[model samples]
Target: MKRFVVCKTCGARVSGLLDSPVALDFITKAEQELLSGGEYGNGDNGNVYISTSDKHHLSYHQDQNRLIGCCGPSPYGLPNLVCICKSEIGREVTDCCTAHYVMLYKERIAIREDNTGLLEKVVSLPVAEDLKSQYEILINFGEIEIVLNALKM
Candidate 1:
């Protein structure tokens, strides 16, 4: 039941979900506050943050306007990350005045499920009713296949 963050437009893997999501509250705090003893995920935005080390298959936004930052891209503005297809994906907050992290927008990215590492199931959040059923069927089919293979032994 491992989930991965991926680009919605191109279906490229972004990052493995952090052991614990860096909460939106931590991202909003002043740099000093975060360095002291900041609590994470106490705010309402409910945004998920990831470390740059976990990132892959993503690049900085090509537009200069979206890249503005004292030390890094401003998190308050539009998404600063993009897939290779050049679709807006997420925001990277590394401003000198704030805690540094990457916030992938729920709308621009999707949660992809890694089940058994045999079959990949890409189910977007807020999944449609029909899609949900289809996903279930897929899972069931995979289980059936595993059982059938075991029976062959």
Candidate 2:
């Protein structure tokens, strides 16, 4: 079977034969132990970012339709993401602590049923003053870490 990245804008399969999709969903350090795939955000555009620092990193969309998977970093001073990576890859500063993705559903990631898939969930991010307080707690004390989030599809 072959794999390709479909443009949400044009619905085009943007991949060549070099595309090799990973079959496992990775976990990050900060999210809760139990999670599920769902919608999360401020009712606008949303993104999902995850970590597998132990192995790899993955990005997708909460829309349960879009995807943004990484193809590992570059070595030739270029990149090899090959498909959707073109749009989302360089968007991040090479050293930025965060990863970027379109955030999609579980079936899209296609984790195997044997080793267990990465769990995901959605939560409302409070607004105004409450949002500010939460931001303070989240960014304070050098506690910056990865969060697997659900966003508005």
Candidate 3:
């Protein structure tokens, strides 16, 4: 059931964990009301807030000016993260003064399910050298039951 947050503009994977929702402490009463029945980022304006630790495939803004800060990159001003395609993706706030987190613009990203589990399930198999071939066979035939049974053996 793992979900990934991908950049809508370039389809680059940004994070593997989409379970963490924006915490209540950070949102005001008005913002809370706006987010009542739905999760964060469902509307046009709010953002999907996640731990700074969960981010991946994202880099700081190329502009050094945007990254200037005392302990880490400044949390103020503009979005600091960019996709591999170099399109602005989100804001990363990790300076010593603030709580470390990332705010992805809801409109700029989409969620996708991770359904490929063959390699992960077979990773611990004793036959390491043959894993690639076995994986290829499973993918070609679209069968994971063979590997699951092999694990039980």
Candidate 4:
């Protein structure tokens, strides 16, 4: 069974499940300043870091336009890869940056299951019941937890 990170608004595949997400602490001075005031930036926000070697998992927009801080030879800045619906999904940390990482916006992306069992279970459920109850059942007894646990590793 495989899973993927998808754009919540347009269902565009952002990346496959990260085999091993790495922690990054290599923000540049300019980026640090931008992170303080950019649209997706917030001082206290947390970021999911993926390696550049895993670039194959990510898909970029055809426009090739760079973001505010992402320009020049080093271009250590992030790229402007928006969803088909025009929503900013995630950013690719260019190789120029000291850390080879891709920072994804967690709130804008969803984890989707590619397995049949879970999809079958979801499709069989009645639509009348509250979604909360359905989610509870799925989390407590279905294969979702197993998949989630595997991602944690």
Return the top candidate by lDDT. 3
lDDT of 4 by residue, 1-153 (tens): 444456778665555333322233465533332221111221135544444343322456565545433332133444455665677666765433343345667787765555544433433356543553344345435557754453342
Better of 1 and 2 by TM-score: 1
TM-score of each: 0.60, 0.19, 0.60, 0.43
lDDT of 3 by residue, 1-153 (tens): 445577888776676444324444443332123222223333235666555666767888888777767766655877788988888888876566555566788788887654664443443346764674465356436676775676664
Give stretches of model 3 more than 4 Å off. 20-22, 27-44, 115-153
lDDT of each: 0.59, 0.25, 0.61, 0.47
Clashing pairs for model 3 are none
Q: After superposition, how far is residue 28 of candidate 1 from its true place, in Å?
A: 9.3
Over 37-66, each residue of candidate 2 has an lDDT whose tens digit, in order, gives 211111022322222211122232123212
**17-121 per-residue lDDT for model 1 (tens digits):** 323233354536655233221112222454545665556668888777888988877667888888777888877777787876677777777666664543233
Query: Pairing residues by index, what is the TM-score of model 2?
Result: 0.19
Q: Count the backbone clashes (under 3 Å) in each candidate.
A: 0, 10, 0, 0
- List residue ranges in candidate 4 displaced over 4 A: 20-44, 53-79, 95-97, 115-153
Candidate rank order under lDDT: 3, 1, 4, 2
User: Which segments of model 1 are wrong by more than 4 Å?
Assistant: 20-43, 117-153
TM-score of 4: 0.43
Residue 134 lDDT in model 4? 49
